[model samples]
Target: MDTYITNKIMAVITTASNVSPGGAPVFKCQSKDDLYSITANLEAILDGIAHALNDEIYIIVKH
Candidate 1:
């Protein structure tokens, strides 16, 4: 099982623009069971951060 999570972090890096670079999302898991647990935790964290930010978060599953 493979899990992917992408979340936008910063909005701007320098005075160039407010367009922040895409954050390299990550997940931690060993097997199917661990995958589920890790994905769940990541979802919760992303949920909280997304609530007060203009960023996008997504999850993808591949077998």
Candidate 2:
């Protein structure tokens, strides 16, 4: 899923940059640390999705 999502994001960003004026467009991060922060947030979102999918709610409630 990460691969799918990251690839899609990259494709979109790449396309935008190519057609963008002066080759500058989208994803404005001030520094590498900011980029890392964004990645950490993305990982947390993916982790939440995984946990939600793997959750067994009804089974636990029945007991």
Candidate 3:
């Protein structure tokens, strides 16, 4: 079987100001619409899945 990345976080999208920088890229959006839009685009571009941790946070992950 071919090996591939699994259960890895590709990016972080959030509107919260307190979300400090860390592992994976973080995208801060001004509005909910922008957040959702960026998250969707990142998901598609990264070939990952978008999982909303909350109303203001979204994480793109690969599995």
Give the 10-residue window scoring lowest on summed lDDT in candidate 3: 17-26
Number of the top candidate by TM-score?
3
Candidate 3 lDDT, 1-63, residue by residue in tens: 999887999999999998976988899999999998999899999999999899988999998
- lDDT string, candidate 1, 1-63, tens digits: 996544444221122233334544443333545544544555455452322122222243221
Residues 2-42 of candidate 2: C-alpha lDDT, one tens digit per residue: 53332222210111223342322233344546544544454
User: What C-alpha lDDT values do all the predictions have?
Assistant: 0.37, 0.29, 0.93
TM-score per model over all chains: 0.36, 0.32, 0.90
Clash count for each candidate, listed in order shown: 0, 0, 0
Best by lDDT: 3
Q: What lDDT, from 0 to 1, does candidate 2 have?
A: 0.29
Q: Which 10-residue span in candidate 2 carries the lowest summed lDDT?
A: 54-63
Residue pairs clashing in model 3 are none
- CA lDDT for candidate 3: 0.93
The better-scoring model by lDDT among 2 and 3 is: 3
